[model samples]
Each structure stands twice: as structure tokens, then as C-alpha cells.
Target: MNPRLKHLVVALSLSLLAAVFTPAHSADTKKADAAAVVQLQQRMDAAEKHYRDAMLAEDEDAAATATTSALAEMKAVVDACTKQRGCAVDTMLTTYERLLKATPQFDDGMPAADEDPLDERDFTAANVPDTANAASLLSEDGQRFVKMVQFNPAVQAGIRRWLTDMRPSLMDSYENYRYMQAQMAPAFKQHGLPEALLFGIMAKESNGKVHVGSRAGAVGPLQFMPATGRRFGLGNDGSGFDTRYDPKASADAAAQYLSERMAQLNNSIELSLAGYNGGEGRALRVFRDTGGRSFWDPDVYNQFPAETKDYVPMVIAAAWLFLHPKEYGIRWPSVSSRPSTITLAQPASLYELTICLGNWGSRDGYLRALRNLNPRWAADDMLPAGTSLNATFRISWLYRFNCAHGQRMALAKQLMASNVQSALVRVGEPTPAGSPQVAVATPAPSAAAAVPERKPAKPVKARHYKVKRGDTMSEIVRKFDCDLGDLAQANKLRKPRYALKPGQSLKLEGCKG
Candidate 1:
């Protein structure tokens, strides 16, 4: 318990006791006796303990549960206090507010509780969208989109996985998607594809994490391979920025790819998705060889690799869950994600922005949102003043209020400027007479003391390193503590994916070592 919270709680207890024994109380007025007061205090303390324990253990689900339980307990206490004639309800309400402030707002990583998992309507009604009366729940386009796909046991399994073990991932996906919906969803809508379908592919591909790069050379929110991405107008834009990492561009490309596949595969969403995961050439060959049979058919399904078999259903399942989250007891956190932009007030990095933003209206803060929106900028890169950044309306407001100029902003700047090297203690070193002394703990020598004359230092010469197998540009730069831009320029390497070959010698310029 926080010391302030403890003091507040004690004050609340005293106020309650005073209220209970007050002589000013009317004779007929109901008063909570000593025993009832003790029980209420115990409940409050127990709820707080449970919440603290869950948080300390980092059990996200348990913490969420405890938070809910604590809030409920506080509400019940407030209600009970209201009914008591002489109870200091204001003090109780203040205590509740303190508890609310004390509780940690866990991010989307925490899965919400699922209610009745045995609901027949969720699965049965899923088969037919029109008859399910989903019009009230979904858009006209959404309803039409759901009707295009058939639900089966495989999809049901996918749904089960999402609702159970993958619930946190699903929640994270939804949260990430919400911030990007304005940028990405319109591309799908223009292509006459469902937003849910776009979400499904993104969720399955990268869980809506924009900068994700796979071991197979696939990159971005939609996980596009370099060769394939180029085919769909996704690649480096000659500005060191990969368009494949751009949510809008990648979503547009995915929509176009899916549309092309649908046109060839008899308008089957499953077949189109299969073409996406498995090679398009293979899916096309399989479709023709199997006489254009359904994707679920044994011959057509077995034609794909095991990955595609899982991929198709999982994508569909994610899509279904996106459309029917409430049916599975998933109440997605409301996001104020209306699109807006903020021009930088001063030079600052994304890390500094994240720190200053302080999670005012969001659980996780604006780091992911900033990364997804501005894929061109690295988290630590300092953007020049007046540079416009893609952000939500809430984030823009937060930026104005908290990030512009404040103690928080100053703190964020200080934190970003901090270096791990400052904490390092060099061992087995006695400073040479002419060597520069670091200003850590050693006291400055007296001005009167004779200082040894030092020879002029030579200009730092450029160093070279041979690229080894499995070495990437990021790894090489980090290994030498080199400036990426400088190293790339020196080596005549392209931006974004700085393609390095084995045994290739790289000129290490502007490196610390």
C-alpha cells in the first residue's frame, strides 16, 4: 500500500467510526454497527491485497480480475455507505477514488474475462449472417462480408484458441488495429473487402505490430516478402523507408492481392487466403488440379502445406472474432482513435514522446501507435522541430498538454539523454600521465600541480570489418556502435534493408570502437 493511500484509508476509517457514533444521528436512521464496519474494512483491505499481489506477480489475467473485483468491492462499499444515515459517504467515495488511482491499468496484454463459453447462438448464427440479424450489430458491408465465408469446425477451433489461450494476443491485435483503422481500413473498404478480413490477415500475420519482420524475409503488418511486396507496389520508397512497413500501403496491397486471388479462385475467401499464405502459383495449380473444389475439401486442403491449412482457418477465425467479440465476452477497450496529426514543438524522439505522454488516456501509452503510424522514424531518432507526426486526437491533445513543456517533458528529455556507458565502471586501469581522465569520481588535480604535456592526437582513421555469415546491417552497426546512416553511406549500401553479403568488407565510419 502507498503511504498516502494508507493515511487516506485510516482517515476514512476514523471518519466512518465518528459518523457511526455521532450524537447528531437521528434515532430512526440506520447506522452501520462496529461489526459491519469491521467487515467492510476487511473486504476493502482484502481486495487491495489481492490486486497488489496479482500486480506484483505480473499475472495479467489475475491482475485484471483483481482490479475488477476491487472496483466492484469499492462500488458496493459506496452503495452500502450511502444507505447508512450517519456514514461519511464522501470519505468512502474518496477512499474508492484513491483505490482506483492506486490500481494499475493493465495493457491489452491482459485478457478480459469470458462469460458463458457454451453459447449456441455464437457458432450457429455465424453460419448465416443475414438470418442472425447482425445488421444492427455490424455495418451493411460487414454483414455482406460475413455472408461470403462459411464457418466450420476448423474455424471454430480457431475461435476457441482466440477466446482462450490467444485472448491476450487478440486483445493486443484489436488495440493496435484501432489506432490504425483510419489509415488501413479505408483501403479495404475501397476495394470492397471487409474490414474484419483485413483485421484477420493482420492479426494472423503480425498481430498488428507494424515493424515485425519474419525470418523468411517477410516484413510489416501484412508480412510481405520483398519480392512479393514489390509486385504489389510495396517496397523501399527510395527514402530509406520501406512501404511494406506502412500500414496503409501494406493493407492496400493485401486487399489488391486478395481481390486478384478471389477473381481467379471462384470468389472463395478461403481459397484467396490460401493463396496468400501458401504460394499463389501453388494455390492456383491446386485449384485447377482439383477441378476448382472447395478449400475445405480433402483433395484441395491436403494440396497445401500444413502451414496453409492452419493459416486459412486461423485467419477466418480471427475475422469472425473481430465481428463477434461481444458474443465471446470480449469488451474491447474504447479508443479515442480519431485521426489527427501533431507537429513537433521541439526536437524529440519517439521514446521521449512516449515518456512524456504518460498514458493519460491509454493503457500502454503511444509508443506502438507512434511506431505503427510513423514507420519511417526509428524510436530513438530525433525528429526536427515542426516535423508533423501521425497521431490520434487524444494523443495530439496529450502531446499539447503534457509533452509540449512541463516537468514531465523535462524528465522525458533527461531520461532519453541518459547513457548506459555512464554507469559502466572501467576496471584494471591506471590512467597514464597524458591520458584524458573521465569525470566520474576522480577529483580534479590542483591548478598549481604540474600537468604532463601530451602529444597531439592523430585523426581517427576509418576502420573495416568483414561481414560474417548470419550478420545483418542492424547487428553490424550495433556491434561496432556505428551510425547506421554513416555506415550505409560509407559502404554504398541502400537504406532500410542494408543488404550485406558474407565476406563483404564494410567501411566502419563514425563508429565508437
Candidate 2:
């Protein structure tokens, strides 16, 4: 063999080895590039998510500023990647551009430090409205109300108290007022009265709680006394239910009552409000004696008691806040006030409904709204199937989603069916020791044993008893030693709140007399 031929063979083998290893190394480099692209994409997604979360911050100005900064930082990262070799710059730049275009404009006005007292700390009884600067903080409209109400030191004090110490009560009133505005406000509007005046009176009277009753027999949202309520058709509605508890009825009565007072008091709103808080008779007598003087007139104001003096100013202050909350840096949370109706698909109470309809879009559940809208029904009353109820659109949506038929509905039903009586242990029962407690089944009495030998009582003819004023069925049953269930069944009386009327006759049952 020639020496040159041997050398050429070795050279060919070396060339083949180089060709094989070069392709393998190129494949590894491609895999590394693909992995780098995935890592870059993930980082971009995380940055976009951070920006979105920052946009939802409660402080509008801070949210806008943070979102803009986040977007700019993301853009810089894309530009840096674009200058690097083998980087997926085209895809990353496209994502960055899309995010920039979709970002909201940052034009929110800065909020004052004192504008959001609630956000400064968790809401507690201790940290309330700071009224030291209330006069300076008053909105233009609030100041106007002050002038109209004869801005005295007492009235200014009332405004400050409502703005700071009683702020939660004010917010609650606004929330409740939103639900009943459709029903109650129209009555005031028809009578040519400001709706804010109605809200103010209602807030002061009951904080928009429809079922509230004063110790003096004043009832409903407006706190009308029994006699005054009767004067305006707010007494019993003949269904064993009082119209004084009805928001719409009470609002109408309040409108009529206020209108009458204004007419009698020479159309002076202050005097009319005074007459509302005090007696109309006293208000008229004072106005007549003063010869049509202002309620703020020292002589005219001195005639009223301390309560009336405080009442007039407090109501005015509440009305002022209702008209101009934003001026005081108060932002009433937006509620879905669109009204809707819901017919119970089955027998369920307000309590059951509230449990099933979890708070999806609200801070608290919908029990208060339900009670306010349907004041006729008690919270625990099991409404008859097909009963119609007034509810908000959000509540209706939740009802359809959770209360219609699902685990939520089933759980709610199970909760409603629960009875403490069923779980009650005998008072004298002993606790089991060192063993799992077992339920014992009571033996059924034999048929013959169950049927007790009966002895008939001497016949005492049944008699009818006349129901006196303020007599409840239970009281009458106890007085006569009658079997309550038997007496109710005999008179066709309903259970749990048997309706009775004066001079109505009830036949005695299971009585010895």
C-alpha cells in the first residue's frame, strides 16, 4: 500500500466525525432558544397581571400612576430584549404594544388626605368623622342649607355630629333609602316637597329601618304615633297587619301630615318641622301668639321643649348631607338599584333566601334589602308558594343562580328544616363516658295500651265570651283555663298570632265552665 493513500483515508474519517457532531450541537442550541422564548413570555404575562391588579386599587390617582409605571417598565424590558441576539423580540414587542394600547388613561384627580377617612383605618367605633374642620369642609350646597336653616351654633353642632360621629348611621340610611326611594320618594314629590326632606326625616326617625317602633307607640319608617297614624290611614289594614309598618303607606302619611302642618303654620318649613316634632296644637298656638314670627325667633323657639329644638336642626342637617355628600368628601357606595320581582318557587322565608343568595357582589348579604322591600312579611314567616316579592336585579340573579336548584338551595333547605327541639336532650339525661353515644328508639305502645280507658266529665254547656279591648287569645285562654289549641280550633282562629277584635264573641272549648 502507498503512504499517501493511508493518509487520505485518515483525513476522510476525521471529516465524517465533524459532520455528525456539528448537527447534534445545532439541535441543542435550537432547544435552548425555544426554552428562552417560553420563559420570556411567562415574565411578560406576570407583569401584565401585576398592572391589572394595581389598576383596581381603591385610590384612583395611585392606581393610575402605578399602572402607568408598570406599563413603562414592561416596554423597557421588551426594548432591551429586542437588542439581544436570538431573542423572540417580535412576539414580546407585540405583546408589550397590545398592553400599552389597552391601558387606561391616567387622568384621575388627586384626592385630598382627609377625603377618605374610612380608608385611613379599618372602620371602628373609635375612628369616626373628624368634625373639627366641618365648617370648612361644608360643600357649597351644605352651606346654602345652613343659611336657609338659620345657621345657629346649635344647628352647626348638629351638622358636625352627623358628619363625624354618626357617619355609619348616615351611610346605612343612604343604602336603605336607595331601595325604598321608588316607593317613598314619589309621595313627597307629588306633594311638591324635596325628596331629600323625606330622606332626612326617615333617617332621623328610623335610619330607614321600616319595622322600627318607638317606645311612645310611634311606628314605621316615619315614627308616627298610633293616633297620628290613624289620622292618615296608617292603622290596621284589616288583614291583621298594620299599615304603619308599610314604607309606602307611612311615606304617604308623612307627606300629608307635613303638608297639613305647613298649611296651618303659614308655610314656614321650620315651623312645619317643629309641628312635626312637637304637637301641631302647640306649634299653631305659638305661631298665633307670636303673630307669624320665624321659628328661629328667640321668643318663638323658646316655647318648644328641648327635644323639638334638637329635632328640627338634626333633620335639617341630615337633609343637607343627603343633597351634598360629595362636597364633604363622602362617596356613597353604588348599589344595583334596578328593581325586579321574584316569585317564590317554593315555600321559603326571608332568612332562607338570604342564606342561599351568598354575597357575590356586595359586602354584606341582602337580608336588609329584602326586609325593607317586603315589610309586610316577618323574617321567619314561611311565605306560601308562589308568593311574589320585590327584589333588586342583583338579588334576582343570585336567586336564580343559587336558590333555584343546586347545592346551595339544598343546603339552605336543610338549614331551614333544622329544629333545636329535635336535637334537644332530656334535661336530666346523663352524658355517656368513654363510648360513642347511641340513639335509643322508644318502643311503640301496644294498640290496647295506647287507647286509654275514658271517663266522661259532667256536662257543662259551652258558653261564648266577648273579647274585651287589648285582650289576646292566649290571655283569654289562660283566664278561663281553656285548652288554647282547642279554643283556637273552635273559633277558626289562626295559629301563633290569632286576630281578635273588641266585642267579637269566641266560643269556649275544653273549659270546665
Candidate 3:
């Protein structure tokens, strides 16, 4: 062949070879990529499922964690694609969009249709205004108070929001507030403040939950920050319990704080609420800068944070509802607020009690009510026998019928005792023999060989006891008839404040028959 033709022939053969092999190699790579995409998609689906499950469980913290993890996984897939050739960005993007679409969208202030409706009749009987006239609902003082507070479009919108989308939360706040009214209202009354104001602030602050603490280090039903709480005599009470968590104490402090703010701001409740939600210093500064102008004054209002602006109006709206529920067609559920006490006949936790009590008269179970009334005790705390807890008359009645030593109580106890760990076995491990099978020399037939009577093992009384579920130090001391002081000393426990955990061992010092 001619040299030029030979060279052309060689080049064409090489090009054809490249064309044939390149596609085969590309196909293998594409297959691997496809598998990888499928695996990543499966992970994303699993993470999305976990997030949905957590949200449905009402576990906001868990849902947040799951979201973070899922986002990280999606980012990993994206990063992996960037490092590889021929990665279908559109495919990955589509997968990402699908994963995001799987997340359920939650509408703020919206309740499910099947969600139990709040029994508004409770608040209606006591708080519903007579005559349905706004004027008739107000006293001379209330009239003046209302005039001082702004009821502009913003406030009206807040009221509508509360009555509509936020109705469930509003009702929940009312129910919780009623239980604490006896404890909180007197403080406001003593300060010559309206009780409605107290309820309004509480509804906005912690939803009337006494033990709630805010992210800003504010603690208790009133959501007082640490420094502010200390200023109002609401910090530690020498018993490791913050007085801020005490409904009466916190309410008294809140009343005092409000009174002080009112004094500084011409007794304007709006400015006072602004100060309560926004920083008091900022409210005071704005008030001084505006030369004691109204909180609704654009100049002064704009100075406060968005939260405070929303807060002042919402609080007023809630207070308005508290005073004029009938006009608005709001009927608060008539909860059994009559106070009572129940002494546990046997060991039980609040969880067990709530289960056995059954929601006979109440809408939900008595767990929240019980927990609110007894904030010092945890819901899962295994209460000792004979532990007397503060409760309502309704709870007392339910306890008598359901929780006082019967089939229900037994079932609850049995349920509480179920050990999932005991049921779980090692996946591939063989079960161990019950008794070691060993052969022994047979000297048993000797006539004189009577195994020396195992001197009846002298009954060794237990000198120490391991704490069991539902065991408390007080109950333990009582059970063993031990002196409290000596028992505490023996166990190195603090006096009058001993806590016992399951599996903890305690010495029976000074325990006598």
C-alpha cells in the first residue's frame, strides 16, 4: 500500500476501536451510577418517613433532628455527583424535589377536623358577659381601661386570629388557666389589677403551663427571664425549686412587675405588655424617647420588636375574650376545678394513674391537670405508697372508681412492668442451659452416708435493699420501719430531699422490727 493510505487506514481502525469500547465502558459506569442513585433515593425516603412519623408523634425536637439528617443526606448525594463524570444532575434534582414533596406541610393555627373540640361551656358560664352588649360587659373601670388600650385594626385582627385559627390553643390555655386561677388570680386582685389581664398574659406566655420554660432562660407560667425573675423574688427558694415555677409566686411577681411598668408608662397596659414581652429597658427607652406617647403611636410602636408588637395586641385580645366570651359565642369548657387530694393506696406513677383513671368526665385524660397541679413531681416519677398528691374532685372520683386496687390497677402495673429488653434475644446465640449438666461420683448408696443435714441456713435478714420500680426513700424507710435520719445518713443522701432510682441499693441502718 502507499504510505499515506496506510497511515489513513491505521487512524480509521483506531477511531473505530475507540468508538466500540468507549460505549461499553460508559454503560458500566452508568449502571453503577443508577444503582447509587437508587440507594441514595432509598435513604432519602427513609429519612423523610422518619421526619413525618416524628411530626405526627408531635415530637418537634425529633422532627427537627430528622430534617437536619435528611438534608445532610441530600447534600451528600449532590456532592457525590459533583465529583463524578456523567452524573445526571436532573435525575438527582428530581429525586431531591420528590424527597422534599414527601414532607407534610403543616399549617400554622390549623387544627385537624377530627381533633376534639374544646368544651367552651366551662368558661361561658362564669365569664360570658350578660346582655351581650359591650358596654354592659364593662364596668366604669373596665370602660376606662379599654379606652386606654388601643383597639385599632391590629388589635381586631389579633382577636379574630385568636377566635378562629388559634381557637384550640386559646381553649387549651383557658382550661389550664382555670386550674391555676385560684392560685394566680388573687395576686392580680390584691394588686387591684383585673383578672382578665392575668389570664391574657398567661395564655400568651406559657399557655398557663406552670413548668414551661422559654429558650431565653425565662422559666415558669409567666415566662420570666432569670435576671427579671430574680428582680421579682422568683429565683431559687433554697430547695432547688425556682419560685418562678410556683404559680402564686410567679403571678404575684408578674403583678408587681406589671404594676411597676404601668407606673412608669402612665398605667398603659399596652406599653406594659410590650415591656413584658420586649425588654423592659427597651420599652422604657421608647416611652421616654416618644415623650410618653401611646404604644399604638407609629413612632413608639415601630421601636419595639415584631414579637412585642404581636404580643401586646394578642394579650389584649385574649383578655377581651376572657371578659366577653358570650358576645363572641365562645363557651369555655366547664372543668371540675374544685380542689381535692388523693392519697395513693399503693405504689404508682402519674403515667399509671392517668391510664387507669380513664377519661370519663374530662375530654382528654387527667395527665396535664395532674401534672400541672403537682409540678414538683414528674409524670414518670414512681410515687411511693401513701403519697398524697394535690388533685381535683373529678380526679379523686375517677381514682376511687378506676385506680384504687382492682383489675384496672393490676393491668396498668403489668403494662408498666413489660420489659422489651427481656423479650429481645441475641440474634444467633444459643440459649444457655438452665442448670450446668455435670456428672458426679456416685457415693450416694452408702448406708452411713447421710448428707449432713444442711443446717437450716440461718435466715440472713437483708441488711440492704435494692430500690425497685415505684420505690421512694420515704416509702423505703417506712417499709423497713427505719429512722429517716439514720437511713439518709447511711445512704449518704440529703435530708428531707432523698431521691431513689431503680436498681439503687440502700443500707438498712437503724432499721428495727
Candidate 4:
């Protein structure tokens, strides 16, 4: 009986030990599974980081192709974990997705390319100024860096609305604003000027169109009436290089001039800008008469004149935009317009460069850039050699590589000789001009393309009339509120009847004082 009981107790004890050890083994297996998942995640994270870093490097284009590889690798990790381990790693996936979206987001929708071209290397380094000596070079060549900003929500929305109302052409106008700011702001700031001032000038001068000029002889981004431009050291470099129209150069002058006025006026940007637009002496005289009061003080401010009042507000508003682009709802461009100096030992015309654009497989982009980079070259001019282009761009390595060893010269030859008249071939279809089959062919008469010079914008003439009652004519003249025949005869109405309707309309074709 004792032997039977002892044997039973020993067997029960062994069974209990087996049960405990079995549960412990299962726990160890579960811990190992968790550890493996964590390890796989770490590996995936490392890969993601590598891709992320690569995306942030000296040349962003390198990441364009690598982007797909990184995405695939990440997806592989997620697939492996979800399928093999049944792991629910929502957080990891989100982090990876965000990295994918954010890596190449332009700085304020503009390239963060290093302003100090000398210091920049391949990828990962910020484009901020680094060296002390760069300032002298900056001053000499003049910095023409344009960084696009969100600006402010109000201004952006207003501009978008105004442009949308005008026409689709305004879409490019909006882009021009962004691009002009990018080209101008750097020089503006470098000279201790506010970026909004540029916007203000653009608003009054060209409505933000970079190519526009004033009939009063103002030209370029700021519409520097040629005399005023020369007074401010802005000139054509004696070769049709209208520096006033150069976003960088004009911005440089505008900033310096504005800064001087501001300092003279005791940091009053309003007064300073008023003087810049109207006349400094006039602004100062107005200030003196107002007992040196604040610009916003209605009593004296109103006396300054309507144009001044409107101008001051415009400057302030534009300045507000510079500081807060996103607030204005303005979406800046993804490209930077900072001036880059690539030495061309020889002069090269923009037209000649277009021909060599065959090297780039197309000249559309180069041709388009000419209006900004080399303003002197008419659209059709055979680029005379040795032209120093002030391109409104922070040219990347891609352009430099394309134009190595005077390759631009050959390109210029082609650009001059190539016909622009072939009715610009559709994109993706290579033009016969550059097609391998017809590479050496000369331009035919039909292919003779002329780069059209933008004609001076026609001035709009408005009619003035005095209110009159019951004045009707077979042809109603819209001036002086008189009979069409009487008014037309007064001016020189060529039309037998300058057809008119009854109302407050001009009674003559031309009303003179």
C-alpha cells in the first residue's frame, strides 16, 4: 500500500512540473515573435532613413528615381510584417508615408538652393550664407535670389480672385509675381529693404508683370524710368542690358533707395515709399507741412494727395504680404529665381543658345528662360557672343553640366539659325530642326521662325463728358455729352456716323482742353 501511494505522488508532482514548463515555453515563443517584429521594424526604419537622407541630398533629381525604390522597400517591410507576423503597425506605416511626402517639399515652395554657390556641394546642406568673403562677390555681381512664399492668405486670395476675373493669362501673372519676388527679395533684403516694397512698386509699375515698362520711360521689374534708372546706377551695360528691368539689379536699387529714404524719414517706410514713387522732396515738404506727423495721421496724410495715400497703403499691404505670404493665400512657385553667375568667358546671345538647345533635346525651356535671363536678346536676335546673362534663377548643376566647355556657344549658333516659325511643334514630338534625320538641315523659308518682340502696350484713352439732357445724334459722340455729329465734327470723325446711343456718352472721338 505504501509503495502504490508514493508512486502516485511522484507521478502527480512530475505532471504539475510538465504543465508549468509547457506554459513557460509558449511564453518564450511569444516574446521571441515580438522581438523579431521589432527587429524587422528597425531594419525598415533604417532603410527609410537612408532613402529619406538620399532624397535630401545635393541633387534632388537623384531622388526622383530612387523614390520608387524606397517606396517599394518600405512596402516590402510592411507586407512582410503583416503577412508573416500578422503585425498591426499603423504608426510605422504613417511615419514612412510622411517621410515620403515631405522629403523634397521646397522651402516655402521655392528651391532652398545655397545662395553661396561657392559653398554648396552635393545634397543635404542648407543654402544659407556661410562665408565672410561672399559679401564682396555678392555686392559686385549683385545677389538676385527670389524665394517664393505663401505671402498672406488675404493677398493670395485677392490676387487669385482678381486674376481669375481678368483671364487665364493671369495665372501666369500670378506666377510672375512669385517669380519676381523670388528674384527681387534677396537683393532687396541684402540692401536692408523690405520685400513688400518690391511688390508695391510692381503693383504701381507693371501690375507684377516682369516684362512691362512705362511710357514715361520706366522699364523692367520696377519700371525704373530710364533717367531714374541711370540716376540709381542702373543701365544697359552699354549692350542693351537694361539693369532696371533686371529683377535683381532693380531690386538692388529700389532697396538701397528705399532704405535711404527710410533712414532720412526716421524709419517711416510709408513716407519713404511715397517719396520713392512721387518725389522725395515733395514727400519731405508734405511731411514738414504736416508738423512731422505720423504717416497714418489722417489730417496731414490726406493733404499729401490721393496717389500718395493709395501708394503708402499699397506698400504697407505688400510688406504685410512679404512677412506673411500664406496668410494672403498666395501660393508661391516651386522654383527659385535667385541669380547665379556661371562664367561664360565669351559672349553668347540668347538666340544662339536656343539652337544648341538641341543638346537638351528641346529649347522650349531655354527659350522661355531668355525673357528672364537675358532680357537684351530680342526673341529673334542672333545672340552675339560674350553676353553675360543675368538669369533669374539659382541655376542648378543640371544647367551647368549642359553648358560645360563653351557648349553654350554651339547652342547659340543653332539658336540663331534654327527657325522658330515652324509653328512650335507639339511637345514630345521632336521638331524636324533637331531631329536626327534633319539635324544639319538649314531653316527653310517656311521654317523661318521669328522671335516676336513684344510691342509696346497700347495706351488706353478714356472719354470725358458733361451730363446733358436729350442730346441725340444719328451717330452719338461720347464726349461733352453733345450731339454725335456736332461732337464728331469738332474732333474729326472719319466715320460718317460714329454710332452712338442716348445716354451720358462721349460727345466726340477726341475731347481736348
Q: RMSD, each candidate, Å? A: 15.6, 14.6, 23.5, 20.5
Worst 10 residues of 2 by lDDT: 117-126
In candidate 4, what are the lDDT values of residues 1-513, reduced to their tens digit?
699999999999999999989899988888988888887788787778777565354443554446556766887777677764536678668856765543332233433333332222311132422221121222312222122122344334444444355333333433455434445656665765544456656655565555575546667767777776787899757654567767678877878777778777766766786787778888788787877776666765666677676655554444343333444444433444443444444444444444433322111344545565555544433333354554432332223434534355565555443333333454446667545433434544443356556889999666655434544332122222244335556544333113233454453454332
Report lDDT per candidate: 0.76, 0.73, 0.72, 0.52
Order the candidate numbers by lDDT, best to worst: 1, 2, 3, 4
Cα lDDT tens digits for candidate 1, 348-424: 87889999887755778889999999888777666889999988655775676567755678899877654445334
Residue-pair clashes per prediction, in order, are: 0, 0, 10, 57
Best by TM-score: 1
lDDT of 4: 0.52
TM-score of each: 0.65, 0.59, 0.57, 0.45
What TM-score does structure 4 among the candidates reach? 0.45
Stretches of candidate 3 exceeding 4 Å from the true structure: 1-145, 425-513
Over 1-513, each residue of candidate 3 has an lDDT whose tens digit, in order, gives: 999999999999999999999999989989987887676667656755664454443233444456556756776776776665666667766766765533322222222333222222323323422111221344643555566677788878989999999999899998897677666767776776777788889998888787776657787888988898999898767865667777878999999999999999889899999999998899999999999999988999999888998999999998887766666877676565656678999988887898888775567878888877777665656789899987765577567656774578888877665443333344444533552333334454565656565666788675989999878765665467676668878888752236577999888998863
Pick by lDDT: which candidate is best? 1
The digit string of per-residue lDDT tens for model 2 on 347-466 reads: 887879999987655567788899889987766567878999988655775676567666777787677655433353444466335434445566667988898788898896679999
